[model samples]
Target: MKKSNQQLTTIKTLFLGLMVLILTSFSEVAAQNDPVRLGFIPLTDCSPIVMAKELGLFKKYGVEVVVTKESSWANIRDKVLTGELDGAHCLYSMPFSVYTGVGGKAGSEMMIAMMLNVNGQAITLSNDFCGKVGFKQMNKVTPVVAAKLKAEKEVTFAMTFPGGTHDLWLRNWMSIAGLNQKAVKIITIPPPQMVANMKVGNMDGYCVGEPWGGVAVKQGIGFTQIASQDIWKDHPEKALVVNKEFSEKRRTDLVKVMKAIMEACIWLDNPANRKKAAAIIGKAPYVNAPADVIENRLMGNYDLGCNQGTEVYSNDYMLFHKGGMVNYPRKSYAIWAMAQYVRFGYLKEAPNYKAIADKLILQDLYEEVAKSMKVKVPNDDMKPFSLTMDKTVFDPNNPAAYLKVVKR
Candidate 1:
């Protein structure tokens, strides 16, 4: 009987060990299978999404992320709103526009977890138009010359989307050139079709993100009239945007997504890894353009193709890894875009722009995500930045004054 009791005890211990192992395995499987879906437009700025997937950053953070390539910004916004996409590599103004019920169907509120990239957008003018305007070089052409030429003809300007960052940049560029946007015909052309549209003379100029701009200049169909960086240095371009409902329901998952993106951003910014990044972006599925076209601009070396000159510009065209400050969603950055929206009449009037910016930008969420990853956050992410043309200083603290100054 004592021998029988000993065997039963051993069997009992074995059962407990098996149960513990099963529980641990179940926990691991649960962590591995938690789904996080992210959407992206096939632009160069979508590097964060690609890099995160390639580098396994999502898995490192206990997330199984699926990054979907969206056809258009409209699709991205709509899918995210209707629960088709958990988040997306979105236009900087997308969250704000949706929140304010401006872009798509009304009453859709969106939120951005972080800013993904700055600069790297360009305004491309067709070679035919450049010849007609008698502008051999983009930099040599003055705003006055552009305006004079524009007045002589009904110049059609194209942007990727209405109420997008590209649209705002295009409008702001025209405004600075003293050209009335209403006087010029403006149309929406998808970024992928920008080159084809310009080739067919459908548009005289277009403001779009790379590698379409680079592709246009490379294909000899158009010339880079102005790099958006020239207009606003390190301008906010894209962000990781999601609907408010997603943020509320999956707060932890959303934060994890932000953290993974932040890590990918850091990885992409590393100078040593730029060549790899260029090659990665050049793949058929992502930017799907020539490796050299993506490589040159990714390295800050630009060939405008309109002029016989090439130069190394600033590292203003950013992706991912610009150290600590680049990934943080600054309130001022959001407000700056809103100010441009107001400047160009996209917004009827600035309505508590900062408060609206605060609601969409999600600086508090960015900080939490960065802190969780042990990434250092900048103390003054939101600060004053003056533009070269108007010499207007935008103060995040005093947004009303900033708007008033812009209006004046």
Candidate 2:
């Protein structure tokens, strides 16, 4: 009887050990699928992440996400760098800038996992400049700025961050219009603070993301002189980015996040859904503006409010998803940015464009998620995009030549 009891106890011990192993395996899987924390600035371009969370799209893809509204781009960059956040709705070129050490930390491995949206930003001129020059009349502003310089005064402009898309757009516009970028003083200001700074006469103009630009117009302090699309139609704007470590360790979570965002992007592109997008993102904790303020401009109904009245751009405006390859992380877009950096003296010498783009774009990851989500992507990653304002065709294959022809 004692021998029998000992055998029974051994059997019980084996069963408990097997159960523990099974529970451990389950716990490991559960830990691998924990909630993803994502960050975004309070801007219209952040609609993808916002929509995903709001619509339960993130959960729908078997991933839980918490979207945090950050104070500035710098904060977003730092948190993502330190692994405080899993990913973020970031400036399209920010990851590249960080990687190549132009305007951010040098050699920080980052990836633009998904292209979020395009053409939502604009350059707004303070009311002071409105009396002199108006919408799309970039040629007229030169004389006014020249006069200001003749008076020995500084004409200041503000962008969100250095070596960011806003900076690139502002510099590109100034360069294409023959304005000396060095002659004008350019500063960095948070997107939400743009209008207030202009009101206090701290800045003459600013290039910033949407809702804020529209907010400036509504406040009667400034008018948008140029939509970013006018400079380069359908240019790549904000992106969803993650560092290499997170990508390597938690690719499954990243794929789920991308799927959720891709669905949101598709929804945003639909005209029927844009009103809902405006309403959702315009709430207090998101963009903190009225729905009308974000909705009208978001749908391409532009009212400069600078005595120019309103203009309609329709499908050519800010698009979350359009054309066949709107969200594809094209290497060309990345290459073109480097070319611009060289032209503007931001970089003394051009880095290997293809190599940097390949590292930073995360095309394979995007396409992998796209395939799983049944979203069709381009067969080739490279695309030939044009810069109409400069009248120069940027050959991504030869970014070096592209930079040589651009205004220095």
Candidate 3:
């Protein structure tokens, strides 16, 4: 009996040891696949990153992702530049700006793994101005007419950042309307505060990304003068930005991050997910607006906030899913943004825009990630598309001439 009891004790101890070994192995694997932190601003189009985390797509691909909400684009740029962040959902032009040293302390080679979204922005005019101008929709009135009417008035307009996409869009929209940028007082305001500032009569008009513009309309503070899609169809808006050094050192991890986001973008673009995405984004911590306000527009329903009734716009607002169009990073998209930079005096000369775009966009990396995930990448990553304002086709092969024609 004593021998049998001793044998039993030895067996129990061995079983316990084996259990510990298995547990330790799992813990190590989990640690190895720990989340890569991603930074983003609080914009509706930031859905892919947000939805990826919410839906567990990141985990499904053996990645742990933590999404950090940043207050401003500058914060997003600075954090990524200083290595405080692994990557970010950033302005499409931000990587170019950082690489060329145009904004935020110069000479940082910020690279974009993919263009995450496009064309879901708007220019809003205050309701007070609507009453004064006697126009039902500010967007319908030509900028030349608007400027002539408000020439004597200050006609203050605001953009989210000085050297950001919002600024360029606002300037381009005004120029197309025949408003001299120098004549109108252009101010910079953080996007989140846009609606509130306009409500308090601090500004007459503003151009900003969605949810904010939708929120402004929802609050009866402003009306949509123009959807950004009208200014440029499927214009590149935001991207996943990282420092070139980090990308080089952590290439595998970078590819994983891009893959995860690409999956999230796919999920977001689904028509069925629109309501759910708006509900998810409308939470106080995200967009901080009514779900209806976000959902209707997110699904391409636009009201313009003057009770003009909602209209179904096309797929101008993108979250990257659908037919493989979103993940393919285009060098032409980056170069077009650079052209705008030069047009607006943010860049003195072209600054080798093509070379810089090629360096930062990483189309090859995007293709590899798509292939590994069995996602189809478009054969032509870059295509020529014309904008309505100048009716100029942006040929990637002839960017210099394209710029010259646009300037003329």
Candidate 4:
């Protein structure tokens, strides 16, 4: 009886050990197969990510993606920092802003993996300035704004995030108009809420990505004063920003995800594919707006609203790939972004520009993916580029000089 009992105990121990090993192996495989969780704000530029998932490009690249629609840029920033999201369709300057202590902790790292899209954002003003500020009417903006401020009326402007593309656009617009930065109020508002807030009189004007600008015009609450491309043609707007751990530890998966997004970008850039792309992204689960409203801008046909008439953006329309010109995470652009922070008082002085760019931009990974996809990278880093808005030349090599001359 004692010998029998001993044999039964040994059998039980071996079975438990085998079961534990099996469970462990299963867990590992499950984790490896788990979908990458990416977040997106409900804007038109999120197409690359949405289309990637919708088109099964992620699965084709041997990974799964779960794209979550986030409410605010602040929410996206927090979740990306806390690892709640692996990455996101993010503002091009957001990671840099976070690392430099503008809107987030000074040293928190959020990595920009690649450019998502460029030149689709716009500055929308309420009907109060409908005739005073026509499309691309930068010259006329300040006087109207100044008149309101002169009357002691609340002259306010809002952007999606501090130190973000829209904030810089708004500030740069304010700067060019020679508006007193100290006199007026500048606040943060999320992109989707911009139109609603404007309708309820929360702000006089706002800068945000499409199709919110398009939506505002469609709803007759506002008019697009200027598209971002009018400020700087082909300027960087949104990016695929990821957490450091995801970029470093899950490199293979990250590359796959980027490749899939790149493929989607290529598809988005094709004119024939844009209508279908717009319809897909307009569904309730994605952008959650009417397909026609999203399609109008997505196709580069803007109804500029409030008797301003229509304008067609042929060459400078929203670019997703532009045959790789739009996707290469350019360090020069990052330098310019940081320089704007200095110019606009977001930062008192410039951070080490190249170091910050190198640390935050996953250039090597982008190059690897670009090569795999046979995408051409424009060798334009550290070069001087001029904005169409003011013709102020930005030499990436001398950001300080650029800042010295820009209006405060």
Who wins the TM-score comparison?
4
The residue ranges of model 3 lying beyond 4 angstroms of the native Cα positions read: 1-34, 131-152, 381-383
Per-residue lDDT tens digits for candidate 1, residues 197-282, read: 88888978899998888898899988787788877877778888886777876777787778788888888787777788879977
| Total clashes for model 4 | 0
lDDT (Cα atoms) of all candidates against the true structure: 0.77, 0.86, 0.77, 0.90
- Candidate achieving higher lDDT, 1 or 4: 4
Name the best candidate (by lDDT).
4
lDDT score at residue 234, model 1, on the 0-100 scale? 72
Q: Can you give the TM-score per candidate against the true fold? A: 0.85, 0.92, 0.85, 0.92
Off by over 4 Å in 1: 1-34, 131-152, 403-408
lDDT of 4 at 282: 90
Collision count of model 1? 3
Model 2 misplaced stretches (Cα beyond 4 Å): 1-31
Error of 4 at 187 (Å): 1.0
Note the residue pairs that clash in candidate 3.
Answer: 35-64, 143-177, 144-177
Candidate 3: Cα lDDT at 377: 83
By the TM-score metric, which is better: model 1 or model 2?
Answer: 2
